[model samples]
Target: MSSLIEGYNYDIFISYCQKDNKHDGWVTEFVDNLKGELESTFKEEISVYFDINPHDGLLETHDVDESLKEKLKCLVFIPIISRTYCDQRSFAWEHEFIAFVEQASKDQFGLKVKLPNGNVAGRVLPVRIYDLDDNDVRLYESVLDTVLRGIEFIYREPGVNRPLKPDDDEKINLNRTKYRNQINKTANAVRDVITALEHYDHEPVTVAKDIFKPASIPSETGKTKIVTGSLILLALIVLGFFLLPKLLKSEGEPEKTIAVLLFQNYSGDPSQEYMCNGLTNEIIGHLYKIKSFDRVVPIDYVLPYRGTDKKPSRIADELKVNYILSGNFNTTRDTVRITAHLIDPRKDKILWQNGFDQPYKRIITIPADIATQIADCLKTNLTALEKQNIERIPTTNLEAYQLIQQTKNQFNTRTYESLNQLYDLSLKAIDLDPGYADAYAGAGSMLILTGTTFQHTAMQTVIEDALKLWRKALELDQNNASAHCGLALYNDWIIWDYIRAEEEFLKAIELSPNNQSFMKGYSEFLQKRNRLEDARAYKVKAEDDPIRIDILSLVLSGEKDEAHKYLNTYLQSKKIFAGEYFIWLEDYEAAKSICEAALQKKSQSMLAPRYQACLALAYYKTNDHHKAQMIIDQLIEKSDISLAGSPEFYTGWYYSGIGKIDSAFYWLEKAYKNRCPEIPWLKVDPGFKNIRSDDRYWDLYERAGHKAYDDYRAGLKRRKSNR
Candidate 1:
C-alpha cells in the first residue's frame, strides 16, 4: 500500500539497527504492533517501510539509495532510539534516519506541521527503547533543531534496565507507561500528522490554522467568504473530535498490578482442592511466560489469602497489588465448571468476568485459555513465544498431571515428612508420564532440599542423583525453572562450583522472575559469594515469608545496632532463636537468658535441637564448661536429624569457643565433607574468631575460595558501602 497522498511510496518509515532485534526481537515486535495499530487507526491502508529482511530483499547489484529514496518519501518517520542507534557510522543512522531528516527538510512541509487545533507538531517521531546519554540526546536535537519528545518503552527497576513489555505493571514501573497505551498514542499521533498533510495538500480548511483561538478570529464582516468557510471548518473539526475513537484517550492511564488467588474449591469434595490450586498456578505460570506481563504476584505471596473471604480491595492493599483475580472451581461426576474475575480493586470494578462449563477431560486446557483471555482483557501484547507457551500442554495424561498438582501442594507444606511425600509423589508422576519435566524436577528438588537441610543423607549419593535428575529435567524441557534452580543448588552445595551455579540461577530467574522461592536461593548464593549488597537487594525483594527476614538479620552485614534492633523486634513474638543473634552481637548474657528460657519452655518439641545448640554456645562463652559439654553431647546425638539448619557449623563453633582446637577442627572437616550450606561463609562468620588466627583455619579458608571472596568484597566495598 502507498501513502494516502500521491507521489509517496510509504506512509511511515521505521528506521532501526539490525542488532537491536538480534536477541529479543524487540524492534521487529515494535514494528509489527505499529502496523496492526495503524490498520485500525486509518480508513486508508497505511504503508510501513520496515526493512525486516533487508539481506534477502536488497541484492548486491540493487541501488539501495534509489530504492530507499522512494520509500523515504513518507509522511512520518519513526526511528527506534537505542544506545547503539546513535552511531553515525551505522547504516540506519547515516542512510535512513539522517537521510530522511535532510530529505524531508527540503520538502514543502519543512518537517513540521500546523494542526487544526492551532498547535505545531513534528513529523519525525522517535520511539525510545533505552534512555540515551546527554551526548546522544544533543546529537538527536542538533538534527531537528528543537526539543526532543516522543513515546518511551523503557522498563526501569532497581538494577534492571530493559525495554518495556506489554505485561509490565505500570504501578511497579517507574516510567508509568503501558505498551498498548503507547502504541495507541503512536497511532493517534500518526493520524494527526496525516490529517494535517492532507489538508495542506488539498489547500482546504484555511480556518483550521487558528480554529480554537479567539484572538485569531476576524471581527470584520467584509470578508464573508472567509467567515463562512471558518464555520464549516469549525463544524467538521468538532465533529471529528467527538467521532474519532482512538484520539479521545491514551494518556494518564492507571497503573495496574494483579494478584491471582487460589481458585475457590466449590466441587463439594475436599479432595478437589488440589486441582483448583493447580489450575491457579498453571494460570499464573502461563502469565509468567508472557514477558510483556511483568507484574503478576508470585504464588507464595498469595498462599496466605487462600481461603479467605476478605474483600478484593483489602487483599490487593495487603499484597501491594492493584488488581486481583479470584474464582471458583466446581466439578460434577463428568463435567467441570470454572468461573474467574479480573478486578480493579481500587475502583471496585470488574474489568472482566468469565465462566466455562466443559467436560472434565478439557480441564487440562482451561487454564491456558483463561490466561490468554486475561492478557487480552488487560490489553497486553502476546509475543509468538508467549502464545506458544500458553497453548502448549505440559502432559496429556490427566492422572500424571493430577500427581504433579498433588506434588505442588505437598511441597508447600515443606516439613521433613512432606518433602519425602512430595518426592514419592513425583516418582509416581514420572511413572505415569515419563516425559514430564516438572515431575523430574520435583523429585530432584527434594534431594537438594533434604541433603542441604539434613546432613544424614549420603553426600555423594545425593550429589549423583541430583545431577542426573536436574540434567534430565532440563534435557526434556530447558525452560523448566525448577530444573535450573535444582542444578544451581547441586553446583553450589555438592561440587562447590560457584560459576556454573550462578549461571543456572540466572537462567531460572530469567525463565520465572515471579518465583520468590527461586529468588530466595539466588539471594543466598549471592550472599555466600560476598556480594552482600546485591544479596540483600534480592533478599528484600523475595518477601514471601516473615521468617526469611529473621534469617536476613543474621546474614546481612550492616550496622550492629540495626541488626540488634531487628532481633529485638523479632524476639517479641519469636524468642526461641534469640541466642543466635545474641551470639552474633557478642552479648553472652542476653543470649544465655533467651536460650535458657526457650529450652525450658520447649525442650521436647522440634525447637529442641536448634535451641540446644544455641544454649550450648552461650554456656561455653559464659565459662560454664560442665553444662556446655552435656548440651553439646545431646546436640551431637540429634544433629543428623534436625530440621533446623547448620547444627554442624554450630557444633564446630561450640568446640572452638571451649578452646578444644582438635575437636573444633575435626567437626569443621566433617561439616565441609557433608557440604554443609554454611561452609562457604566460613571465612567471615563471627563465631569462628577463636580459630581465625590458627594456620588450619587459613588453610580451610583458602580451600573455600577465600582469595576470591577478598577480591569480590574489595570491589563490592568500593561499589556499595551501605551494606
Candidate 2:
C-alpha cells in the first residue's frame, strides 16, 4: 500500500486456503477489510501480502521462508482459519500457522534462554478471522492453541465505528468468555511448564493433596475384604453423624465478633465532633487488643453507619458481627459525658450499659476504664499486660491530643490544603509540647508524603526533617509503634535504607503485635525487597481489621481486581484514611479520584494537590501524555511545590514514557539521591523494561540495591546451563 514497505520490511502476511478463497469469494473481502482496519487503527499504510494476489509471477518467485520470516517481524499476523484451511495442499495456511506457533514458543522460551545464553529470538502473535467447529478446530489446534495461550487478542470488526449487532454481541461475549477460560487453563499449563523447566535449577517440594487415602493392601484378599471395608465405612459414617456435632459443641462455639460504632454527637455543637470520634476510636482500639475475648472491629470500618437513617441493629447485622457497641458523647467546654451500651445482635438484648462524666482532658483515658469495666462484666480474663497496653496513652497534653485528632481528620480528607493545614497544626502541636511522640511521628509521615505529592521545593529537607521528628519520637518512647512505622517508611522510601527499614518494621511489629497498619507497612517493605512469599505471610498475620487486612492481602496476593473492588466499596460506604493505601497498591487513578472528591467537600485540603500529581502519573501509565502534562501543569500553577526534591523519581517516569532514555536516567539518578522509595522497584518495573538491556539501565538497577535482580539473572543462567 505504501512505497515505504518495499524500502523497509513486511507490513502484513495473509495466510489462507486458496480453495476457500476461490470457492467462497469471501477471503479477498476479509483480507481487504483487515488491511483497512489495520491502517485505520495504526494510522499508517499497511502492505498486505495475500497468497491469492494477482501478481502470479511475483508469488511464484517469492522467497517463502524469507517472506514468512519478514512477516513474523512485522507488527501483526492475520491467519484466516476456515474449515478448508486443514487441507494439506494449503501450503500458505500450513506454513504461516506453523511459523506463528514456532515463533511464539521460541519467543516465550528463547528470550528466557537468551538472557543467559546470549541468543536472540522472534515473537509471534495471532489473529483468527474465520470460525471453525470443534472437529475442524482440531486440525490446527496446536498452533491456534499455542498462539491463543501466548498472546493477548486485539479485536477488530468489519464496520467503521459501529457497535456490534445483537447476534454479534452475543457471539463476541461468548468468545470472550471462552477465551478467558482457555487463557486461565493455558496460564496453569504454562506455570507447570515453567516449574518443570526450573526443576534442574531447584528442588521441587511435594504438594499436599486434598483427598487423603490409606495405602492399599495387597490384592490377595478381595471380595470379603471389600465387604468388610464397606461395613466399616457405614459404621464410621454413622459414628461421624452422631459425634461431629457433639465434638463441635464440646470444643465450644466460635468466638463472636463485635464492632463499636462511632458515638453520636448529641452535644449539639458540631465543633465537638473530634472528641466523640476520638473517644470512639480509642475504645475500639482498646477492645481490639483483647485477642482472647470477642473480636472488636475498628470504628473506621463502622463509620459508614453514622448520620445514616439505618438502625444500629441493622448495621450490626450487616457487618455480620454478634455484638454492637453504640454510644453518645456530650461535651461542654470543661467536662465530657459519655453513655455507652453493648447490644447482642442475635438476642436483640442490651448486654451492658454505662455512663461516665469526667474532666474533658481525662476523656482520653475513658476508653481503658470502660474496656476494663466491660471485660469484668463479660467475665473475660484481661491479662495484666493487655490491660496495661489498653491503658497506655502516650501523651497527656490536651493540646497534643487535639492536634493529633485534627491532623488525622485532615489527613483522611487527603487534599493538598488539608495536608498543609495538618502539617502546620502538627508542627504547632510539637512546638506546644516537644515531648509529644505521636505528634512528631504524624508530622514526619506527613512531611514524607508532602515531599512526594506536592513536589515540594525543599522535599529532601522536608523528608530529612520528618526523619528527625520520627527519630525523636522513637527516642522519647522506644516502644512507640507509630514512630517506629514512620522511621521504617523513611528508611524504605526516602533513604533507600532497606536494612534499617526492615529492622524498624520488625521492631514496630514486636512492640505492637496486633497493630494492622504496622504489619501492612512491614508487608509492603518485604514486597519491595522481592520477598513475595514473606510479604504474603506478614500480610496474612496482620490483624484482621477488614479494610486493612483485605487491602493488604489483595495487594500481596497480586489480586488487583479484588483490591480495587474492596477499596471502591470502602470509599463508597465509609470515610477513612486510604489515600496512601491506594498509592501503595499503585492504583494512582483511584487515589487521585478519591482525593478530588474530597477536595470538593473540603476545598482547602492540601492532600488534593499531591493526589492530582499521582493522577498525572497514572495518565502517563496509560500513555495519555497530554493529559498527564496538563495535570502536572495545573499542580505547578496552583501549588508552590518544586520537583527538585524528588525530580529524578518523577521525571524518570515521565521521560521513560517519551523514550527519552538519557533524561530518564538523569532523573532516576536524582530520585536515588533523594532516596525516593520507588527506586528499588525500578528493576522489575515494566515502564523501564524497554531500556533494561542498556548498560546504563543495569548500572541503575545495581545501584538501586535490588539484589534480587542479580539473583534472577543468576537463576536464568543456571537454567540455561542446565538446559
Candidate 3:
C-alpha cells in the first residue's frame, strides 16, 4: 500500500532481527500491538509492512532487492532494536535501517522533521528492547545527531536485561514500565511524525490567511485599470506563496538552533577586541531574554572558537548547532561599524547579513537591534517584556558602560589575577556611575569569590561587604537579575539560609527565566538540600567545575564507581576534585599522593591552603601526625586569619583526627560563626565523622540551618534504598 502522505510505500515499516521473534514472537507481538494502536489513533487507514519470515540478505549492497528499497520509503521506520539488531553485518541494519535513513534524508520531508507540536523526530524510531551498551548508543547517536532517546521496552532487574513481556509484573520491574504503554507511545510518535510529514509542505497555509487577500476592482473600471488590479492581486499571492512558509515555519519559531560568537575586532587593535567580546555578550544576553528562542546555545559553547580561523559551518558541526551568528566590529573615532552574518553552517551559506554604522556613543543599541532583526528574519515572535529589556539602555554615560564591559571581560581570561582585576574594574565602574547595578553586583560577587576561593579577605568581611554591595545594587535597580543572584549565593554559601536562598533564586528566575546559569545554581542548591528527584528535573548548563559537580552528586547518591569515573576526567587539569572525592571515600593514601604531586608543581600560593590542607588532612588520617603538623604549621605561619573553611577549618580536621574533640569543636564553631563554605556539607563530610556522635555536633549541624542531623541522615537512608 502507498503511504498516507503519498510518494511512499507504507505508513510504517517494522525492521528487526528474525531471532527477536524466535523468543516467543516478541517482535511480532509488538508489531501487532502497534498496528492495533495505530488503527484507533488515525482516522485514515494506517498501512504497516511487517515481514514474518526475514532473510539475512548479507550479500553485496547491489544484491539487495529493489522492491525492499521502495518498501523502506515509509513515513516512520520502527527498528526493533534488540541485542543483535545493530550489528554491522546484519541485513536489516544495512539494507533496511541505514538504507531508509539515506533514502528519507534525500526525500522531500528530510530524515528528521519538526512535528506540528514543535518537537523534532527522526525517521528511524527505535523500539529498544534491550538496554544498549554505551558504544552502541554512541554509534546510533552519531548517525542520528542527537541523544539516543526512544521508547524503552526492556524489563530491567538486578541481572535481567531483556525484552519486556506482555504478562510481566511491572511492580517488580526496575523500569516500572508496562508493556502496553510502550506500544501506545510508539503509535502516538508514529502519528506525530506522519502528521508532520503530511503538512510539512503546506505550513504556509497557516500564515497565508493574513497575507493573501482578495482584491475587488471597480465594476466600471477601464481595461488597463482592471488588468493592473488583477496583476497586483496575482503578485500578492505569489509573494505569500514564495515567502510565508520560510517565515512562519513552526508558527514563527523556526527550528534553527544558533550561537552568537564573539565579533572580531576589525580595528586591528587588541584593546578593541574586548569591545567585540562585549558586543558578543550583549547580543547573546538579548537573545537569551527572547522567550521564543528556545534553542539559543550559550556563549560558553563558542568560547573556544574566539581567535580561530575555523569556518562557521565547522564550528557549528562541532557545537551541534545548525546556525552560527558571527560578525566583525570596528570603531573609527566617533562612529562604530559592525557587520553580522547569520549563517546556516551545515550548508556554509549565509542566511542573513547586515551592517550598522552608528555613533560609537549609541553602540549600546546595536546589539539589541541586531538581535531583534535576526529574530524577525528567523520568524521568532518576541514578548513585549523581552523587547523592553533588550532595548533598555543602561547608563547614558558611555565611559561607565565601557568600564562595565571591560570589567566583565576579565573573568573570561581565567587567570589567578583576574578575580582581583575584576573586582578593581567593577569598583572603578561603580565609582564612575553609582547607579550601575551590574557593576555593584559584580563587585559583591567578587568579594565572596576572592575571599572564599583565594583567601584574599576575611570570611566575615566578605559576607558583610557582599551583602551591602548586593543590597545597594538592588536598591538602585529593583529589576536587576545579577543582584538577585548575588544575594542568592550569599544566603546559600555564607548564611546557609535555605529559605532566603530559595526566595532569592526564585526571584532571579522570575526576572530572567532563560538564564540557565541561575537554574544550574538552583539545581545544585536543591541537590545540596538532598532533593535529588527535584534536582534531576532541571537540566541546566554548569558554569564551572561541571564534572566535579557531577561527581559530587554521584558520590552523594552512593554511586562511587560513577563518581570516580567522572573524577578521573578531571584528574590532570583539576586534581582537587579527585582529592576531595577520595577523602569522602576514605582513600586517604591516594588523596595524599595526588595532593603531594599537585603541590610539587607551580607557585606555593597558586592553590594555597587548598591542596596543602587536603595533603595535611590526608597525613593525619594516615597516622602520619608529624607530616600533618608540619603542613599545618606552614599554613599557620602564612596567615593568622583563615580563608574559606580552610587553615582554621584545616586545624579542625587535624584536631578531629587526633581525637581532640573539644579542640575540633572549638575551631569548627569558629568556622561556623564565620559561615564557612564547608558548613553546608555537615551531614556528608567525612571530616567531622569522629565528633558526629557528640551532642555538640548535632547542635552545630542544626545551627548551621540544615535539617536535624539524625532526621537528615534518616531521610537520606529512606530516599536511597541501597540504590
RMSD (CA, angstroms), candidate 2: 27.4
Ranking by TM-score: 1, 3, 2
Instruction: List clash counts for every candidate, in order.
Output: 3, 14, 0
Candidate 2 per-residue lDDT over residues 1-723, each given as its tens digit: 432223324445556666556654556755565454455444445565676742211233355556556555432345555555554445555456566556644432331211122111122323343433333443454343211223222222221112112233323331222333323432332233333333323222222121212211111135635754675467558757454344332365545477777788999999878777777777766775654554566555676777778766678778767778788999778998999988876677888999989998887788888887777766554544456667677678888888787777555434337456778888999888888877888888777666653344455567667767776776565556777778777667765555556656765664555566776787777666555555565676554334554565566567867877778765674242465457546766666566556656763333344345455666665567788788656644542344443434645655674567887787677667756656766754434655677788877776665553345435534633443
Q: Candidate 3: which stretches are off by over 4 Å? A: 1-256, 268-270, 295-301, 414-418, 514-516, 532-540, 543-550, 553-574, 603-607, 635-639, 642-645, 657-660, 708-723
Query: 434-536, model 1: which lDDT tens digit per residue?
Result: 8988788888887666555433444445666766777677657666788888877766765565655665787677666656777788888876665554566
Best of the candidates, TM-score? 1
TM-score of 3: 0.59
lDDT of each: 0.72, 0.57, 0.72
Please list all clashing residue pairs in model 1, or write none if there are none.
Answer: 167-292, 167-293, 167-294
Segments in model 1 whose C-alpha atoms lie over 4 Å from true places? 1-255, 290-294, 304-307, 381-387, 413-417, 452-463, 544-558, 603-611, 635-648, 658-662, 706-723
Instruction: Give the TM-scores of the predictions, in the order they appear.
Output: 0.61, 0.50, 0.59
Q: How accurate is candidate 2 locally (lDDT)?
A: 0.57
